[model samples]
Target: MLYSEKVMEHFTNPRNVGEIPDADGVGEVGNAKCGDIMKMYLKIDNGIVTDCKFKTFGCGAAIATSSAATEMIKGQPIETVMKLTNKAVIDSLDGLPAQKLHCSVLAEQAVKAALSDYYTKNGIDPAPILGEIGECAHCAQ
Candidate 1:
């Protein structure tokens, strides 16, 4: 499938591609059917996302989405980051193939998962905010 110039750029040179040893929050999600996995790291300070990073084991689309997701959330307030969606990530990359769209979903979920972890660590009930962090049903389809 053909990818956008932005997608190719990120696939070749993914940003925030590493782990934060002292991350305030960490989240991991995977699609066993496709063998794609994503791990996200976040550092929050005073309700703002100070930093973000990720490690993705999957296709170019997955890597690109992860890169875009981190860049979008970094330096933003937690409230803003929480509103992030797969559509936003996909749009940021110009777009993704219909089949590869699942990657974008994974990216969104990963970020929310990290935020949930952050809230939980801080003694807050993430369930009330993040809802349910579930696997990508589209990936399984």
Candidate 2:
């Protein structure tokens, strides 16, 4: 199969599939690889990610990765959430096909992008904290 079992599961039953209109931070990233898009929303309270949601217009891999990513970061502290890596998301999903690896990168980037937005919107520079969001072949320019 092109996708792992976990990938199918998440794609079939994605978590946090909507949005939080009042989200403290929000990020929308487009995938250059397949021209897909993923938008993440985060609600932070007391430095904690009290809630998170995602909307992905992509393949099964993208939707699965986004679902797993939101599940991984929700309710976690910003510091912890910022440390999330694509490797972790890929690992959590068991494993993905080589071509689908870019999907995980989108998950991580979207989360950090949202966090960085949160920091920037709060008048605090995100560079010192979250560092650079990194350029991704999957992310748009």
Candidate 3:
């Protein structure tokens, strides 16, 4: 498969490829069967995402997507980060092939899942499930 130079770069030298020991919140996503899985950690302070990190086991696309997502959310408000989408992640990386699109989606989902955990830890509920809100069943899963 052809991979973009940017994806190759990040995949070879992924940043934020670890976990926070005392994370404010943690989000874990993906299945082993899909040949990809991601676990994200975040430190939120005063409604802002002070730091973000992740551990991903997948293809180059998955690693690049996770790294990009972490970089995107750092120092941004949690609410703002929660608005992130797969399109934004892909756009940040220039683009990814159609087959690898779900990698970006996984990254986006991991970030939001982490944020959800953060909110729960702070005794607040994150927004309702995105897929459950009239979204297509295919995308929901």
Candidate 4:
């Protein structure tokens, strides 16, 4: 499979590739069984996603997707970041091959997960669009 030069570039030298200690919200997504694990850290303030960062262990596509997703969300409103979709992340990369599309989904999910953490921590209900699942240790349980 021929990966795009851009994908390789981001994968080789990903930006915001680390954790945010004492982060306002942290989203851990995908398990070892899934062959990809991504964790996103966010610093939100007054409804704005002030900073975004991620650590990913997966294929080049996964790394690039995580990198791009973090870059996309930084400085954007938390609500806007929550609205970002896997399709948008994939499109931002020009497009990922069919098999690699799931990586983008993981990235998108991670962002939502992070935002959910933020809302839960602050005792603010997440937007209805987030689908308000039953609370777990991460959410409102």
Candidate 5:
């Protein structure tokens, strides 16, 4: 499959890779069928995303999406990051193969999952906002 220049760039040199020692929130998601797993870390301070990082074990698409997603939210406000969608991630990467689109979905979900963790840790209800953080159903089918 062909990947965009942006995708290849990210795959070759991912950004914000690794864990934050004192992350305010963390999230992990995987697609059992695809054997792709992603973990995201966030450091929020004063309602802004001071930092973001991720670790992904999957194909090049997964790694690229994770890298782009982290770069998208690093210095944004939490509310702004909450609005991040897979489409945005895909657009940032120029695009992904149709079959690999699920990777972008995972990126979006991972961010929400981390936000959910942050809310929960702060004694806020994540269910009403984040709904359920579950495995990627796209590849399961």
Candidate 6:
């Protein structure tokens, strides 16, 4: 497979690859078909995402997608981050192989899952914010 230059860059040097000791919210998602697991950590302060991190155990596309997703949401308001989509992530990486499109879906789900967790932690129902995780049966989210 021919990978985009941007994909290679992010995969080789992933950003925000770590953990947040006092994370406000955390999400873990796995691709049932491939067993590609992704864990996302978020630190929200005053309705803004102060920081974001992730750990993905999968292919180069997975790592690159997660890295781009985190970079996209960091320092942005929670509302904006909520609007982040798989297409956006894919575009940010200059595109992924057709088979690896699911990686972008995982990245988007992982972030939403984390935001849902954040809402739950703050005593707010995630349904309004995230429309409930696992709503999509195909991706199990």
Please state every model's RMSD to the true fold in angstroms: 1.1, 1.7, 2.7, 4.8, 1.3, 2.0
Error of 5 at 91 (Å): 0.4
Cα deviation of 43, candidate 4, in Å: 0.2
lDDT of 1 by residue, 1-141 (tens): 899999999999999999999999999998556778999999999999999999999999999999999999999999999999999999999999988988999999999999999999999999989888877987656
> Which number leads on TM-score?
1
What is candidate 5's lDDT per residue for 1-141, written digit by digit as tens?
A: 899999999999999999998999998888545768889999999999999999999999999999999999999998899889999999999989999988999999999999999999999998987777665667657
Looking at model 1, residue 89 earns an lDDT score of 100
Per-residue CA lDDT of candidate 6, range 1-141, in tens? 988999999999999999998999999997546668899999999989999999999889889999999999999998899999999999998888888888888899999999988888889999876775553243554
lDDT of 2 by residue, 1-141 (tens): 478889999998999999999999998876546667889999999999999999999989989999999999999999899999999999999999998888889889899999989999999999999888876774544
Cα lDDT of model 4 by residue, 1-141, tens digit: 877877888888898999899899998887766678889999988989899889998889999999999999999997798789889988888888888877888888889888888878989787665874222222221
* Local distance difference test values of all predictions, in order: 0.94, 0.91, 0.82, 0.84, 0.92, 0.89
Error of 4 at 3 (Å): 1.1
> Number of clashing residue pairs in every model?
0, 0, 0, 0, 0, 2
Question: What TM-score, over all chains together, does every model reach?
Answer: 0.96, 0.94, 0.89, 0.89, 0.94, 0.92
lDDT of 4 at 90: 85
Candidate 5 wrongly placed segments (more than 4 Å): 132-134
Worst 10 residues of 6 by lDDT: 132-141
Off by over 4 Å in 6: 31-33, 135-141
